[model samples]
Target: MIKILIVDDDIGICKILQDFFEFKGYETCIASKGKEALDLAKKEKPHLVFLDIGLPDISGMEVLREIKKSDPTVKVIMITAYDEEERIKEAEKNGASDYVVKPFSLEYLNEITLRKVYKQLFEDLRTEHQELTNTYGQIVFTLARTLEEKDPYTKGHSERVSQYSLDIANELGLSENEKTIVSHAALLHNIGNMSLDDDILNKKHEFTNEEKEVVKKHCIVGYEILQILDNFQEHALIIRHHHERIDGNGYPDNKKGEEIPFLSRILTIADAYDAMTSKRPYREKISSPIEAVNELIKNKGIQFEPELVNAFINVLAKKQIIIKENIQ
Candidate 1:
């Protein structure tokens, strides 16, 4: 679980924040004084801190300096009643992740906290890399689940696609590094849909041409969002082009066979299969796993890479494949 430290002299404020953060599924520690905050921060090594600008024992700004000096990576978000520009600048200069003024909205604080958690996860990924991929993998999947929750029909799609993609990667004898990248791409493939309109995303009917065009833009949006982060730069391209087809009939960019990235070609099959077998709002009945594989073989060299289709089928033939019940 992501840990948080809350530092405020007011007992009511501390209790309220503790309740809210705990309800949000975060592990939280609270300190009423700046000196106590430093001691807790050093002992617990919390990933993030919400530091009050004024504290009973010591100045919060001074405590912030000490915390950063002790652990530069620990992110601090200043909480202040004063909104003076100078204090804000000083906080920024001292490396505060963000700030919230007194009497702020609980919703705003929730948003800020979630954003910082993801940022902290990314930082951990950079420092630990492969050793911590499993831990970070769950974090990323949780983000993907947040997207899936917006549309009921797609609840487990990301996990299924991720597993299928990983199996395909193994079939191709990919390196551990390459497989990990593929898994991340698979997990986040549809994250761009988060920016889409809910009506179109969960419509019980086919999309009109304009709505379809809007839907296609998610690839570009997801790519833009992921490419900004250094850790996901390489996987960004695969996510952007996962919908591209080999026959030059795909969207965003009309890249044909060999023109499309290889990993993306592999992802295409995995993504399509899960979507085929999973229930969607527009389609009441999902195709069975066997039927979905047949569709893949039928569409070989057109919607997917012919060689990969054959490989995926061969791999599945050797294993007993059982898809979860389709969500209604």
Candidate 2:
């Protein structure tokens, strides 16, 4: 049977909701105070909680926090009077699953309850999806680390790129989701290098035109490999375009300007900065940090998005986030 907890200080309101939910085939519990609500939540462990924002013993927000802390998966639907937008927001941030203002119609409450019940019914599938996502992320990380182990010169390059990309993304005020895409794409940017010959990756001398052509194929190779995983389809596209130049002079497809993915633009600058500062098979010596920054400025609009270069410089100057030497 489905269990629902209704927490309200008003005895009349609690009785009304209890009768309504119980009539709808739910086993209902009620609490008229914050402490009582928390204790009931711990003991009953209901699948759903309709929590009020105001309680006599402690604030409803505190009770919501305690309930969530104990069981994050519990669906907490907050109850609030009108003109409590701030409190509603607080409840949401504290992990309330939904909110219903006072004096709501029974029909509306039923709709909300039905939605919650549906979620509860499919909760196992959601858990499995989350597990798969986590497992996939671990696999990507292991692949990146293995790629690095293949070439000592580029060791730790992906980590530095990911860090730099995150700093730049934060500076640009990108959304959390965008930052996540940038982070993962940067970490596995060179995953295609895993397919390259060891001599190509580790050569101490400059590559011939033919060798350079072969070397650049890692971008496409990485994209193909990453895209094979469902979780990495979008990220694979970013990785593929990371090597493309802003002027459309880059490899494979030669996509240029705004044609490149936005996060890819951010990843490009980070990748270049790290590559310059790091020792590469083609470079005689690692460029100094100052030199790398200058290169980014010089190549702006040619190799990277001009705005991203400016923001990246600002991130470096303002945040004091250091890029360790020999990253790329």
Candidate 3:
């Protein structure tokens, strides 16, 4: 039987979704919080997810990343209260298959769930969703590349961040599951950048307070962006918390210290290293590896994790993978 996982904070909604999906001859599971949903997604491995865009603990976007990382093929359809602009843009950028707004008709949503997930559920000879996971992921990846290419400073930034995060993950002795989750997070962590204007992104002048707020919004934007993606739940923390600092000075949420997910903290290190080592549209690059490492260390316990900072320093020293402001 096809299985559907419903992640939502409203107890009433959870019960409604559960009863509805069960009536449709499908097995269903429910979790009221984002973290619980993630845990259930792993244990249940549901074929599809009816995910809400908001949650009590973490936002639905973070949960979406985690879900997608665990199983790329998991069909996810976002259920939101209304079509909020940033959230919608974020969902599309993060590769959501489709969405349904709240106060929705159960009959209509049921039809949608079946039409999209039936192929993944059945081995029908005429099924079109037989390879839905891999197929949809490629299409999203192409879109992700396109989004990044719009900004030279960030072109291939996702790829490099993924690589660096993978390297750090290996050194930290992460479990296979954790490593995969981290890798996926690195690739799509900046998907929220799609909501940002090019003019704001490439400005040579310093940002006004308003512009700075916009810049700081990318993390939350990313969190909202991936809320509808089937496979992006586990990775959402990485995207949302990567900008968070050890001292709790980061944007969107000022999550402090270990309050941030470990993967996100690790990703932050990788992201900063890459940004420092690359050229931006407005600023000259910092081209010295030793200086970059020093800068990271100098700010540790403030901007970075002390242990992760030390571990990364060792990696750079041993591999001569010095952090600089420019590459090539």
RMSD of each: 16.1, 12.5, 19.6
Candidate 3 clash figure, as a count: 20
Candidate 2 is scored at a TM of 0.57
Cα lDDT listed for each candidate? 0.85, 0.85, 0.80
TM-score of 1: 0.57
Best by TM-score: 3
What is the C-alpha local distance difference test score of candidate 1? 0.85
Q: RMSD in Å for candidate 3, one decimal?
A: 19.6
Worst 10 residues of 2 by lDDT: 319-328
- Write candidate 3's Cα lDDT for 90-148 as tens digits: 87566566788888899888676567656654553234443664576676567678888
For model 3, give the 10-residue run with minimal summed lDDT. Answer: 121-130
Off by over 4 Å in 3: 1-136, 322-328
lDDT of 2 by residue, 212-263 (tens): 8998898899888777677788789999998899999997789999999998
Query: What lDDT, from 0 to 1, does candidate 3 have?
Result: 0.80
Task: Single out the weakest 10-residue window by summed lDDT for candidate 1.
Answer: 319-328
TM-score of each: 0.57, 0.57, 0.58
